[model samples]
Target: MSQGQHWREQLHEAAAQGDTASLLKVIRSAVAERADVGDYTLMSRLLKRIGRDEASRAGLRPVRVYIARSVTVESWLPYLAVEAAAAGFWLETKVGGYGSFAQELMSPEGALRDFNPDLVVFVTDVEDVAGGLPDACATGKPELVRAEVERGVKTMEDMLTAFRHHHRARLLVQGLCVPDPPVLGDAGDANWEASESRATQRINEQIAALCRRLGDAAFFDENRLASRFGKARWRDERMFRYCRLSIAAEFFAPYARALTHSIKVLFLPPHKVLCTDLDNTLWGGIVGEDKPSGILTGTDFPGNCYRTYQRYLKQLAARGILLAVVSKNNEKDVREAFRVRAQDLALTLDDFISLKISWQDKAVSLRELAQELSLGLDSFVLIDDDSVECEAVRQQVPGVLVIQAPREEPWRLTECVMASGAFDTLSVTAEDRARSDEYRAQAQRAQLENRAASREEFLASLQIVCRFISALEAPLSRTVQLINKTNQFNLTTRRYGTSEVESFAADPGGLALALRARDRFGDAGVIGIALCRTQDGTCTIDTLLLSCRVIGRGIESALLWYIARWAASLGANRLAGEYIPTAKNQPCADFYPRHGFRPAREAGGKQSRICYVLDLATQMPEKPAWIQTEEDLNNEPGPSCARVNEEFAR
Candidate 1:
């Protein structure tokens, strides 16, 4: 058999055996030979097929892939193209010549027209930018350079916009990986080296701006990759004077894999809730005996760290992550700490979803918290300064992520929690920042509910006001905060960046609403957010989550009514939502159904996949008298007693 046929047969055999390494070797050989024959189109198709097969086998189910194409070094294109395709993404390949200005080069609109990939990768060497710049700079005027920069920025923005508008695809711009200075000494004018560095930096900046504008863009710093691997591995003197194809392949391959995975994750809802431990975990001293006033918290060294940690926890609460305190402290002391000393403390009792302050084992308290919140122990992140407690939770809850509280320093505690990257979301919204306060307010409402004889009396005596902000103009900060922090009450739990939220608002069918609640005690600020998208005469609740503090106050029901009524006014026929149960959001497990939604299907128990459809033709429920109808809450200043206490009330 001929060399090409022999390699193809070997590749087929290797693929049959599920031997990735051997299959890749065959693919590489085919790519090398095809490049020699200059049949790039064939190479592209073959690579795409391999990628699709691999991704399917891996169960990745990738929707799109971005391929950066260069004409000058045509040999490398097929290899990179196949690599991306093998990873399971539909390829979005940019076609342009080597040493061509990235700004001046236009991708064949046809190549992207049909594929409509979800990601666009920019692959090119330093020479590509350098090659296109000199002609524009020959006149050497400041105005010309400025104009060129503007054009470059505009070009990148246009390219990114095309993908975003056409396919809602994310863009991944790779930095050029140039060989170390030594390899370039033997090639071309030495002065080109400095120019290449400057040009590459400019191009990278422009690409970063595009990503900023596009919101979902990612820039892979390949310069760091080249630096990690010595330059000699990629530098070539003959084929392309200043190319680093080998290094690009090595780094880009793994990067492509990561990017593809990220896209998949970005669309899926987040795991809800984060449970924590107290008593030396959230604060410095044990609260059981230490006078609440003596507890370590506030704006001082180690105390400051604990305070900072509490602030971080408060931020989490605002984002909708249910905060619960499971401690073996006396209830009286703990309650006092929150009431008297907690003003100076890092977190207050109101911020927690549930507080179990009995002298019970931590495991028992954790179970109680989970039960009260209607969550499973598996979703809890048991953090304690005591390694013994961490180990205990690990043994009791196998899936729970146990983190050791920073024993040596208090400030490092927040870093430890953030580093888990478990709660790393795209952005924080305004509603998120108000979450702790809302939850606190909810707790007070619950207290009122317990005091009154009837539900009507409790709600009326409590003087509750559920203000619906029809036009959420100024509280953009709170809106973004909720998008970032609220987890448990979040229906879709789709975390969005600030720019992405802005873009959503710009779109015709996207709507964002913020809700604020208040009663006799305090203003809850912007506590709830409902993000929806309109499609085919239906309004889909992309996210519907509220602070756990506000869980029992009927806020969720009110918010649902608001959405349904708004959809009716918009002439939408159906209102839809999903109830994706998570470790912490069990409190809302029956939320949709309780609000008159029916289950469309069930994906076994692995996913309680429910699709609710509400006919907008029905008469909308009357707004509750107890629920405030004021559209703006920011007009009312926060209560005076708000900053009176800082520490827990022990």
Candidate 2:
């Protein structure tokens, strides 16, 4: 037998034996051979058999998802689960029967409740919501159209209310897909006043607004996907009418990818940095050999391709992904190009926070970049046009993601990167947009530390300020962002959504504080969060987390000190905290005890949980002299405080 056939046999054996290593080897071999990997059915089967093997292997836990659709979806869910793996998520998928979403979710003892999903997706279409389109020809009045749309939207809202009351799953309602040939034909949207088309559009808009109002719900746009994929090609009349399947089998691949991408972004954190090659990757020619002017760039020929690609990278940087340059070139030449003739270039030297222009290997330079930025290897995306560089980073740095640029049509580079779906996010907090500035400030802080005579002098000279404010009175989105992204400095490592954070703040005697920090270097937006519940004049710390970027600067200790003082003012005499260890949070294992909190309880055997208690009345902890602290009451309250919780007056 040929080598390809032998590899296939080995794959089958590995699948049978449930060997993840062997399965990965087969997939890698297929890529090396430049052969088709087929429909990935064998890989899907292997993944299902391994359950959460990918999560353990990839250093990420699987997201338990329960999908409820108006049509049959079991056949396509496996494909979506595989796609989610690319985003570092292993989806533990469970699907409900056709047209059973409302019944299952609303019922007290239903399959949805038993599954206890982390995320619940309701894949519905126009047919499910619209009881056939309103007769546009019957009445040209806009009032009739508005009334019909409201009726359809009300049904969805009712179902959403039931789901919210029943379970704490993040609800993702699939938007309506434009019907094949659009039942009303070309005239469906004629004169830009088609009642049927207008009603469906209104329904989607209301659903999006409802998600914002609820703070936990999100709407995925299936209508745009169906239109882009060609409504005619997306619909299978026989399957739709007989089998009641709205999405055709052939279109399931992209559809599954879109769904999986949406779900992944909700849980999987996006990359923090983008490292690119300065030579052909960023421009059309090598700057080392091709003189700055001679290099193909600007608004001409192949140069335009590089310009377009550079523009996209700049856009990514603008939204707060740090940019760095790692190239095998002389630093003088690269600097000269960006300095003297920067008007011709879309990217400038200021765009990159770090620049390593040397003859070192790409992997080595990438590691240096990560160290300088104080970010993990898993949080970097290395983009190079050279296949050798890409492969080297993939082999040497296991966690770093490698994106190879398209050499044939350089303009296609942006499309290639975007298609990876790596940078997609549902929300962009203030902290996210300021990440580039934050890292730049960190570099300055390091320089200052080196010049200081002592650590205390360094911190005092830097003049760090901490603002403690209730989450309800602070930026809710930024607080949620820090709570979810922070790992090492997180005590409990429990993630909460916006709505859940609101719920915690709204509960009686529950307190949630978001801490913002600023130093002489720059502002670190909403770097910490503290959630506690008080009962019988005793407060229990539910979660106290700080961003890794702000740690080691005595911020953690200062935060806890302020928490004790705040609790005392609220009439709480006792404070409690717990340390729950995890693979990534080992740095915080002794956090509670180190801060003078005595052990209260311990359990969970191997996964030991240790609790600590502090008497707030007896212990009057002072904020560090080096750090200035204050309660922020100037900003307006967030939506979280608008609930039935007791509002505080200034």
On lDDT, the candidate that comes out on top is 2
Each model's lDDT comes to 0.59, 0.76
lDDT of 2 by residue, 155-237 (tens): 78888877787677887888876554544556645554655666688888988887766655678998888888887778788
Where is model 2 more than 4 Å wrong at Cα? Answer: 1-10, 21-38, 53-60, 107-109, 134-142, 187-190, 536-538, 569-574, 599-601, 615-620, 633-650
Q: TM-score for all predictions?
A: 0.55, 0.90
Residue 413 local lDDT, model 2: 84
Q: Model 1: per-residue lDDT, tens digit, 467-584?
A: 6663245356456556754667777666664455565455566666678777787776667888777777898887887865556667788787766655654557788878876545
Clash count, one per candidate: 46, 0
Which lDDT value does model 2 have at 325?
Answer: 89
lDDT of 2: 0.76
